[model samples]
Target chain A: MNNMKTIFLCLAILIFLVGGVSNAGTYLDSAHGNSTYGVDRTSTTQYATGHCAHCHEQHASIGGDEPSPDSPAGPDDYLLFSDNHTSQTVNFCFGCHRGTVGGYQTGGLVNRSYSYRAGGWTSDTLDNILQAFTYGPPASTTSSSHKLDDIKTFITGKWGYTANSNPCIACHNPHAVQGDPANSASSAKSSGTRGYPVSLPSDHADKYVWDVYGDDAGEKMSNYVYQAPYRSGSTSIYEPDGSTTTTDGTNLTDYVTLCTDCHHYSPTPVSTRLGNTNLRDIDWAASVHGGKASWSKTDADERKLPYKAEEKNYVLACTDCHEPHGSPNYCYLIRKEVNGATTAVAADTNTDWDTLCTRCHTYTHESNSCINCHYHGALHESNPNQPLF
Target chain B: MKKSLIYIVSIIFFIVLCSQVNAEVAGNCANCHTMHNSQSGSDMATYGGTSGNNPCLTRGDCIGCHAYDTSGTDNVVNIDGSLVPQVWHNGTKDLAAGNFKYIASNDNDRKGHNVAAIDPEDTAAMFGTNGAPGAENALGITAANFSCAGKYGCHGDRAVTDEIISVKGAHHADDGTIDGMSTGTSYRFLKGVLGLENTNTPWQNISPTDHNEYKGINGPDTTSSTTTPANATISGLCGECHGYYHGTNTTETGGTTSPWIRHPTDFSLPSIGEYASYTTYSIVAPVARTDVSAVSDTVNPGGTTDDIVMCLSCHGAHATNFYKLMRWEYDSTTLATALEGCNVCHTSKN
Candidate 1:
């Protein structure tokens, strides 16, 4: 009877082990999975549907057929079927993301001509997004933009990303994209989904959403809660109702917080960062646009903003005046006009007081009438002893 | 006979009073004239080594009558043992208005005005260390020239050259008070000139209180919106030539800012802060009179009207031994001495 009990216990343990593997594979098969890459005959094959021949070969494959031109072999390192050079990481994403493939819409192209990437794009949209990546020829001396060939260099050197990675996979999960659907409201575009903590590498727990609702009972309480893609030093999961829970997993909808993940962690000082890196979290704190004093002076309903009733409070977000992706104007300003002026002002042009200041001031004064009340215009000229009229 | 004697006594007394009032050109007429225009057949009209039929029935021209004799004595007409003051002289004593001999002696160009026949035409560069700054003269005059009692000279006609036309009807007038009116009321025969003046003669040993009183205003316009005042002051009189440096007008000052774009003149010294500490009047940077009626010949002249900043605070009417006709050596003075010179007014800078 004791030998019979031992056989039954071993058989039950094997069944439990198989059940755990199936559950893990099901989680990875969610809609956020990378359907284009990393497919092979393995225990996790049941979760993926893409063919493995697209990226790998079991034995020696044809020479010079690698996806990237810089790859050392036909089947590059780790049988990536592409070049493993750091510069070719973006090119790999470009394959499926650029226009339709196999008569099916693969993904959006970066150029403005395509409809997939056309939600709210302008002529300079791609150039603005490319500003964060460092993979192009060296810019001329006159160019004011930042440039680096390796996206991983910025991740490791400035953003403290220790794991080897590419830009898209670094911020997005190829398997399970886990976050509340409501969190998509904060993206630069509504089409993009929120990021999930599981997408990050195992060693990158410190980069996950935590204390997002400030409900952490320990010393890990966060000063401010942020939306997904943006990370703080919190371990708590985000919730939909603006509250946090230890048992359930959800994400907040404050998309500007996601941008802070890379921006706020720069190794260089905010004052010295190239291309105005301090605009979002740092400069916004001290700027007049960020302060509530000017906004509080007027009724909230009387404000001239273009937000919904629920989002029309005096407290402004960075997106109120700036477009995250790109804009025709330099610095990605939302509107090309300033003050009350009719003309669209360039970044280098002088401020037009009528168009810009009267937006909130609401008074109809002449453009050159600053000296009527202030001591700024021409000098006094009449005789002092003359009778005043 | 008794009434005739009384009339003669009255006439003599009136002449003596006239002599005392017009002391600058007093005494008998013979001292400046020759009746026959000949003395021992050497024509008296040819005196002073000049050739001309002497006009005004006088022995010499304007220069000769105003200059000193070879004996180094001033050409003065004495009467009743009273030595009347001469307008021009080369004696050791210098008058309140400096003598023209300095310019006549071929000395430095700055010694005196380059009056015709006394000195050559001014050939010096404009805006020199000793000349007026180009910004200070709104008339755009690039060089300095001289004429007798006319446009370029010191009498009423500021736009004419004839000596008789400029000094017309000014010599005989005996009024000594400068009531900001007629030539008789003008101080030092500056006909039609507007300003306050010290009526007291023998203009020497002048103290801060005993000096010439200048007309000014109560205070500057706080808004900095006005320029010239309706009434003229001593600074306005100087502005007749140096127009740019006087008023707060942008046109005059060539600036776009005001109650002043340049240093302010005829404005009151504020009675607050460091200015209140000035209990005593400074001879170096003397204040002027905003209300001429309030003036008194006393030390430490006190009143709100007595605290005005005037052009005379930094300049002298006649020539001085310093550059730009400044009353003091501005370059040599240090800022630490706040109690003297510019620091007296610019107290905080010290």
Candidate 2:
């Protein structure tokens, strides 16, 4: 990233434009002019991270794309100064954290598009790079109704904004948003309790007593096994209530919603929807690996989920199976059949069944690795072949 | 004396007629020409006696004279400005199966011709189109190493007709030109025709400098020139069939905001680039082509983009039909789908 530092540097230059080249009205340092774009969801347009003046000048635009000439500049629609026209547009995000002079720890998220120049990047593979940004209901592609009304609406939803809020200012102070001082890893985030510093809420009301980042976790956290819950081989933790104790706060191991404040819990049951099918709710409750906390406590075979090893076992969020951002692999593939053929693209085979299966179960050293051993279905006899392309 | 002479003459006459019919492609006047003007029940013809397949010639002639080209040599020498390809049978011509060019054979692959499909019911025969509607329904779409994507099992109806073609010779019209005036006007025009941005309207000739060569090589000219008709037709042929691909500029609808678009920018299809999609929208940027970068001083000064693509770019349309219209990169039907296509333009250097 020769330009990794350029990301942070762009923001510093914006400080002078906010008001003056002084440290008074700017976001981090007042150089350009004063800006109030870092305010919360409830704050006024001038002082919140969710404000308009955050990323745009309303008059002196920044990026290549410009608004129509006849369009008035008063209350800029969507608060965006201009459209992000370049193919390397992720730089707009990197211009802050991955910029010069101040980021490393938080500058890790790679804009997969800018870096990986191919056809499409699988959402799962690319997620490895965008770890810091929290997402809304993913692409909602799974027969579920989690559809994002539109892109910005989709973006705002995931970044902790209502459907009708301003998105530009949510992460930038236009005056100070230049890829300079504002781009520092530390500067990217406004002082907040959230993992990301782009936008934080006032009163932080979304920080309710529910799961994610707040209260409902007190009961589940009691059984917290530091590293890998089941890895250390220590089985001492238990609740006052027995195994069947239900949400009465009994014997629940994986009940803890550490990051639930930003992400909501699923209302679905944990038994029926295991095959990574149409899981409506956000929580991974009914998934094949959902009840594992308790299941692993009993059956060893319950650990079939790849990326599920306790030495690997950790908080299995919606991200484990799917990426929140868009993916090149059709269906945002955790895995898929090559060319829609029988063979898998990356894993042992191309089938989502194979990839998802091998994610947990061991395979051939035979082909349909799962079918090789366990007699699952007709897949047993199908002479599995890879695609030519 | 009268009876005897009559008998002898009639027998000789019958003998001569039989000999002539046998010498030809074994068909009755209908072998080379279509009669009754019917696109109906007769796949080849109503009373057609035939071999399993045929090339550019009739099936009867194919099996009659040239069943298998044992000569192991290429005797085809196209005379300049000729309407047909010159097939030299002077022992110099190679006794080989012709690619799906002048000779439309039963060989399974061709760049523009992707119609054969896997018969879900059989899997033995490459399910063809000369069957019933139900059979057509069963023949799913499949990419027979025709495209570089290897993923487009792209089977759409021809010109808005739902009649799926599981067997085809040329999907694009002859020679990429649209009727005439347009170069890449085969389908929707390479850069969008009926849609909003139709830039390829005024198609350019191979060399804008001269109009003579352009007109002469307008059709499938086997003639050797500074730029052959085959070469000129390659891009048009590709763009014609691959209408939506060449130069595309996409705008995501009502999303937070769709990317901007003024002039159509190049967005490589998965077929051209090392296609990969991490997320729904996470596409890897398109890489530049190695071949174009080599001789590209004018079009792409520093060689940033891959200008040459499609069939003719790699395979000389005249010299090949083997390995599916491939000019180079031949192994067999199997290998052609793999590394062959990709390696053609990707020079070993970078």
Candidate 3:
């Protein structure tokens, strides 16, 4: 019996050691799973690193006490401490991920707005995730946000999502989502790693690779047959900040494929900014902005930098003119800055579309408002033969 | 005196209880077996009723028992305190071997191995039968004639043609520890294959330390055996049906070095260059271990034999949502369009 006991103990020790070295699930590598600075900061047991208690309350309690005030009464859905979502301002994630930390939680939570990281706009004021989502007035026509309530409602009805679940989860898996580690290190606008933060929501569970976009082939903009745009005003500088050498978009994310997963011709979501379902469809393939057609500005002088020759055929990244979360700009969630220009250069009134258009194209056309002739179906639907200037 | 006797009795009871709990299959005989086909004036078979009386006088056949209907939220179900892993479940989570539901779906022949009865044979013009795509032309095994056990299947004795007889007493006689000694003691009952079975969680919710410990070798010389070799490895077991896929055989795999004809398996990942970046083990693209007696989750690449690539590095054993049961979306043209699979290990190729 003594010999058997010793053998059993040895086997148990072996199993434990082997399992410990393996490091286990993908969540352990995520930002939330970081040992020094992650969800464990909120753990009642300080050294319980990467424990599920940060998000899930197994028995609707924590450390032999009731959960924090942010949480709902009793065991919440999925054993989450708080209700998945409550409202635009009272969402569960806002407890820690917002600009202002709640009294119950620890402070010093830092996050950079997407515009600053991707567009190199140093003047971006949206410091946290919540501010970016609620940039402008609720349902305002001029400047619009992603509309969290609308997203929550749509996902619940269509994808059978649980009621009040965080709509942000529609695009981001918190457990497996990667964070901008560079942001934690410094305040530099262009310091971000440009990791693929947003998982394809339709295939959210399938996400495996991240942070290797610059090195990988298909994930980078260079693989899209792209011709890099120039920085605003400077003829030699590139669009992704002031790179002297011309590029084939080696430093841009393939936002076209990621955004088009939902914003395609048929199954496009209802547009909150336009206040209509009919305004949703954006078939990039058939449009002048998308692939399949070349820019038909006859004179090279008429076009701006990067479009040196006539009939330039190049695919454009969606981030070239738009902000992902929201912006303080006047129309279409347009960027506060574009083509590495000074901040707020693209902000304009509804009629003043040239402010955004001239960031890439030369302001030579008669109409200051490009939308009058360059609507979604203008060139592709009305006059297929006519070339875009 | 009385208190000491009580303490000693309690200790012995705890030991006996632990031993009983470790038994692979411990439950009432009637839960699985049937003396006669009649029970409470009805057939004892769990599926298809009286008409589907299975061989070996068991309650159900392989699919009938293993693929028992779940709550659409569970991968495992308890029958008389005996835990059973489901291969066809609607739950969000699936076991390590994967689920068979993908292949059973309409027009999804490439999604998985299309077993007979459970799944229809491939009807594509290229494949009149459900023959494996990369399999050698001589060894004929197709979906039309494939089954859950015996000659054409993975589990139990491959030489035996009878499904029930091939895996005769495996379940009842299982001792839990898998030493590759017999059908009952083999890893997941894969006959002669050697591995450490994750008995507690089975194959569901696997972690690096808690996953099956697969057998592998560094710089393998498989020139001697044309068929699945005497030394059993997980890759070697797969080589039984798909010998062409096994990388060690010089004739089958062209050559062991780079600039190869066929993609190599059972080959050590070079520690230097891009391969070294994969210092951590990824469940998405798992490797095998040189020593099955111990396990390590970290990858040493060129430094150790534990970084040897196997057939499973690219494919799932049962099924997946991707084409040809690939672990990742191989058909995606752009990385932005879908998740990376081949590039997970190839590192620089993406």
Candidate 4:
């Protein structure tokens, strides 16, 4: 009796160490059997017996002990109950995650669809994930959809991603979500792959994880922290007067490091593959928009910027004037359009140039009459002797 | 025998007439000289002179002799009561050539040249002030002073110091003709001064023809093209006092090109443009004569014979009411009429 008690205690300890057994409430578990196809169809598994049975079976069952007792099922490829129509890796996830599945109907999980609005899918049922992942116009066209198989091939071929890896699993870990929801107040949902140690073919080992600490317990987790690979090196923070202070390790919250990881050195190939990819980090360090003192508070006062600050130490971040996931205007410009008539033409009076400039410099007159002070432009344009403007 | 006697008498009369015509100081010897150096028991030489025991035998020093009396008239009187041209007159009269009287009464250094004894060296002008470009200090004329006659002075030998010594022979042997006279050849006894002569006696109330003609040049398109007509010009005389301001070369003033450089002195005005309209000389912006032969008997040369730019075109030879010795109030001139100081030549710029 003592030995039996000891064996039971040891088994319990082993189970706890290796993670507990999958149960009904879990993502892989089901409450009802697969044969019953009604509103209470709560199973993600096809056989409704165990977790492995959700995707595969030991042998094809015929008449007895089968959930679908009336149906003949002597053969199925890969031990799957149904045929794989789409060659995409994400299609497997889409089958149950789609609203037509048993999990959503039973109010077990939210229904998510990749079908775009133009394909007769209502905007109400669509998620932003689908919008960002979908490559097509507001429609569910097959050709326009980004195939996971193709992406997997391309990433492996171009970026040297491991051949065996699936594009969906590369960024998302399905089993264990790493972040603690209690510690964060961010609106952005944490990815399950957050703490996964990912080894790149390149020299660096990127652990896709947050530097969790007690000090940051109640702070909102930034989206940039999740996306950027953890890099260990000195990163310089610039001051308003072009001076810099170097700190050990990259600031995970900074967009400069986060966006430049894949974009900086590998721009030429990426730009060739995806047109209109703005590798902005290349220009950001020296640009006036980035942090350089191109505009001043005096200039701002002249233009009448409403929220004028006492100190001229303000610097702009990438998100200040741009939307990351596209906006209605071209280049995802946040406030005003920049394309306008050239400086010489008198007809440029109606251009939005002033409106764009006045985003910071608000007091400058929004007209095409710059001739009094900027006389060189007009003089150069008029004088044939002076070819330069 | 009667014809010979008549010829001899005529020859003697001609010699006496020539002697009087050449005389600059024609008066009784006693009026200017005192051999004993004593008069009425007082030492005349030591009593009234800049230096003690005045050996030149003059009444006073250069300043004293030329300065006006308390009643504002000439201090020195000739035997015939004809007064010499006083260089330093009181402000009650505006003399022909200009006077140093304004310097003392106004106490304005810019009112006159700040000659020694008449006034102190021009403190404001030594390093230049009031927008006027400075004189070339490299030439060792950091301060302006005057001598009676020498290179540094204005009369007979500009380099000499003692006025009576340098111009001693000139006073007694001066002939008032452009060609025949050696001493007074430099128009108004300025020694080597070259200019066209006019008929204003004692130098006052000058008209275009009555004014002293300044030497200048016609054109080879630009003033800087040739160096032939430089040193003898009236502008060159002013350049001796203010050296860096002479050239038509733009680089000298840290500028770019011709005409745009320092104003083109001694350069001919273009006859085809707005300059042609200035046929009647404006007294405010007078040009000089490039051809000295063009001046004859007339007291007013009517047309464009005076179209060449000279130093005096923008400035007065003597004192004026304007700053920088400018002939007119350049700042007060307006752009509306285009008939102002600079606009008189730069017609289209406004």
Candidate 5:
């Protein structure tokens, strides 16, 4: 009886271990794992894309030689070539995702900005991620971007960020990150690939879901209330590809909900680029751009054609006037192009709002006057300060 | 003849029952075990070790199979059809027992258990004597006897001296439920210890709903010299080696009651006051359950039999990135933001 029981238990244990087989379907369909253009798995003609060897070196060295750009100390954990991150610019993911300088880039890649990709706005497509982050310095001096160092520090302190972790993983799940979808003219103009690129930063370890921002019942724009903005001249056609129908579900992503995962009411991060000043908290649900808020005592006649079409009551997505990555126009990541217009919004001093704000509203007031009452914490501020400290 | 015939029928019934059970370690046998340790004119041993040196016919040693030096962000990796959990992972998500990544990276003794095979002994003043701080007088855990597994260590048979030999047959043994009857059936292979193993997330990802259920006894009576008590609790497993920490000796654990010297273990959480707010189980400061049959997402604290304070509530079993292997930033957290690890139970102290 004892021996029979023992045999049964062994069989059970074996079944349990085998049950942990996970699929790489999400990664296989991503841009980095696309076999036709992805990184060389073993060599030019070897395993190719979708192979685990592209990022992971299980034996520490490949073909009896260590992989390039490895840490001098030793091989990194999880058999990666280098550490996850060492500095703001020195991230492991940027090794292949970067373009032109500092980091190497794999060929046949199409990396575009959020405005051009998702919003269907005419804007400069970024060559690499480094180009996006390096917008403020030398290239477009006064432009602002998300401080990677600040993200690294904040996430490390709050989350379970280890020595080998990359801060980018907080918002981006590399394995399951999708690209902008096709059909740029549809209101359902989804972001590339099938899955959503961004994730809830706090829930960093959750399994990557393919359609996190899908057009499903509880997904994408359906999770929140939103109204699609109008195109430049066409009042019938809406933004996100000049669609005739407004995308309340199935196509548009809820940028307000996504960005506010970190930029919301509390735990405001201190930006290293901004001399350690606390980032301003945003209450987008109560803002004028948010459809629920009152627009009384405001000039609707001063608005642009797109704004005039809806009388400035259409709820705005964060990408409606801002770029997620980096932008040529400073104003703290204000989009270079807005409402399908070709004319680029010029970069100005931190206080100036007309360069970007005037794209939708014809504000001829003082440079910083528009932001005084039209900001995130507008009503509560005793003294409204400039953006980016 | 009738008894022998019945035994054959019992064996057949058991085989069918075993076929339906889920196992912990599976996949190709050659992935872990090697008959000769040689493959296709080249050595097949992992962790840079020679072919035939590893014990139990394994391709790599304990640390070699469990951990590796890497900068990648993976807590678990696929090893030939098997998902192997890493103890020294570089990822943000460490397993429930904890990670040994800090021991090699930081070289700080306080960050991890100073396994002799992984790193050297603790050179700090408190452990400079080469003896564990809270070890019992009879079984003094010195540097000479310390290792990952042996008679002196946590895992495997305590009666055996050889590390690999102590845990022989454990990996292949049938570990259905943690009954603590055998080494493999024990909680995480800890001999004679009982607790519900976290199968969800494979012990890598932890949350309020998904985590290990630890065993504990409410209100431990320890006024005399009782070192190795067969309590079957998770705290009792720690007390088997570090006995003084769980005792009530005035010079050691101070007193068992409120105005105590050292922190108390095997005590029930008070339901009233700020502690009551901790009705939800925290992955940071986890309380042990009185009943280890199942894992509870909620905590019934303050005079309840559930939610017993254990040593793991304050410290990790293997390693962490904080000083003293704390589950949180104990050294850096201030009084203003006292809602971290320690303040979870001792609410008013903040």
Candidate 6:
């Protein structure tokens, strides 16, 4: 019994370090799994004992249940402690981190809850229409989770039904994962054969090239992208700003093409990282890093940016100006400056619709409302040169 | 016979004397300066004494016809003594008084005239406030204020050339012009009261080589064809001034690119369109957004290529309606229509 106690304790510590069994299980090779949990020579089963269940358990749902099925008593398939799909702590990952679990909640309050129906997500694009961190009444399974599941079921079931399909996890993690996933595309490899649709972490080697945009759905699971002047440049490569490129991995275009699962604008070979289906999302349209227009881009004429055409080169990606998933500002995105202040430009305030307006700050006009400028009155009615309504 | 001859000689002398005085008033400044050294001063009403610096003008020289039109001419400040009533009209002569001739000051170089009007204004501030000077606000010309709400173009009119004009006066005078002054093609101080000598033209044809593609300083490298005019690359010339419209949310207004890249009228922007069919129970979808894919409703982001608004169609440098300084009548909204702006001139409506 003493030895058994030691074994369980060691397994618990191992699970915590590898961020639970879900990821540790992904590295079940001769090199990683053995080192993490000590190989059970008697059993080398897939999804054995130490997997997703070792670290996470969904419970105390959005509203239905309090500490619903709290651990030790969970489900069979994915280790759902309860209906976390509908938690007041909307973000399943925020439950333990945002001061919920005792003794383990010490790294300051991590506000992880997000509104799936706000701004770009909802019908209201107005700035004051809603708040960003309003702990919405525990997501009634009907409003949030069901809508997503229903969409996901259709996406996984059909190939090309809707021009603009709503694939649930297309932009989401569902697991509320923090930090990097081990089998992350960086260290992943393709495990399954080509043509069929099964991808293991190792199968995703980084040869992410493309004829027309890209074709990676798992790219969202990775943290790298190509940083160049033109998105369509021949020299484009997968890059995640602040990281270096490696010739050691396979740049799999097939896996990255998965991004198109939701970017259903057209019928292209490769899927895009942005929403526009037929056309690109205009990422390079105004993507400047740190809000300064003079940045290096492979397609840019130069970086000395004058006040007009190609005046300042832009760097891009949602993460360039925002947090991992979403933020407090407009559409939960990021920007360089806000409402005139420069220092601490990106994070000074929540990314709001108004914050988005200030991104093009020097633009002068009659109202602070974005509708007055970009949309400006009604179509064909408002004068183009003059923005005054 | 001797007595009749003496009467005829006296009559001839009177005719010659009268012609001499009329000739003096008809010519340009040289007419007055030709004899400024000896004047029997006449004005006791509105004229101030001429200083050595003002050799071209004399006391009350502009008092009669111009006296009422240029209410502050030679001595007063504004036209009606009230700045609000300052007149900016042109083409017609400044003849509110009984005498009505071109009442321009003898010396346009304000120093040659009176103090009521300011000496000069800065013209760079008028062209969209992003640093592109336009008609009437042409640089190197004399203006009254740097912040003149210098107007140009009109809204809701078909495109026209040389339609731009300018308005002018002195200090205590209006600042910017409601009409255009010049567009790299025109200049101030033409021979006539109005510039260009009345041969109409606002913006002049410029060589891209002489000016920068985006800065209007040096020409950019582009292929030219017989069908297209010389130096007619849209990127080089058009972007030098309207670069603000092209900047993304990340870029500030006035930012430039080698080739201009304007916004394609979408949701990320305000509802500002030529005529919006999107308000108050109008089931029109919103403008398209780059980030948004799905929405509460499906017909979102409005239309893309078929129904989009571009910068060139709705705007012409020389055509407009309001104050003759805009491109369209945005204030008017004809309901339940695709409206106009982008779809107007680009009639690919299939």
DockQ winner: 5
Deviation (Å) of A169 in candidate 1: 53
| Whole-model lDDT values for every prediction | 0.40, 0.27, 0.61, 0.39, 0.62, 0.25
List CA RMSD, all candidates. Answer: 33.6, 28.3, 21.8, 39.5, 18.3, 31.9
Q: What DockQ, between 0 and 1, does each candidate earn?
A: 0.00, 0.00, 0.01, 0.00, 0.02, 0.00
**lDDT measured at residue B133 in model 6 versus the true structure, 0 to 100:** 28
| lDDT digits (tens) for residues A1-389 of candidate 6 | 99999999999999797774343221232111223331111111222222222222211111111123344322212223322333223333333333323312222222221111100112112111111222112322111111233333334324422312223223322222121212221221122211111222222221111112222444332233323111111122222211124311122222223333333223322222123223233222222331224433322442221113354432233322332232333222332222112112232232333445433333433434544433312222343332221
Query: Where does candidate 3 chain B have its weakest 10-residue lDDT segment?
Result: B125-134
Q: Which is the better candidate, 4 or 5, if ranked by TM-score? A: 5
Better of 2 and 3 by TM-score: 3
**Candidate 6 chain B: worst-modelled 10 consecutive residues by lDDT:** B208-217
- lDDT tens string, model 6, B106-208? 3332111111232232222333333232211222212332211122111111022111122112211221221122222211211011111111111111221
Quote the lDDT for B185 in model 3. 73
**Cα shift from native, residue A43, model 5 (Å):** 5.0
B1-350: candidate 4 lDDT, tens digit per residue:
99999999999999987676643566655555567666787655432243445546765555555553524664233434435556665545455445665565435666555566655554543534211232332222323445434444445544455565555566556445443133355544555446665445335535544555666554323222011223455665555554344543333321322213235565667654335455555556667675664443221222434577766777766555554455655323221221245445644322
TM-score of model 3, chain A? 0.78
TM-score of chain B of 6: 0.25
Among all candidates shown, the one with the greatest lDDT: 5
Which candidate, 1 or 4, has the higher TM-score? 4
lDDT of 5 at B248: 56
The superposed Cα distance between candidate 5 and the true structure at residue A133, in angstroms, equals 1.0
Model 4 Cα shift for residue A296 (angstroms): 45
Clashes in predicted model 1: 15
What tier of docking accuracy does candidate 5 attain? incorrect
Per-residue lDDT of model 1, residues B1-350, tens digit only: 99999999999999897666763455465665568776787666543455455645565654555452534555353533435444445565544444555555445445444556456535544323323332233332324344445555555555555544555555556555566465556655565545544545354325655555666665433211012222556666565554445554453331322223245566666555445655556666767666665345432223557777766776655544443334554323221221135556644322
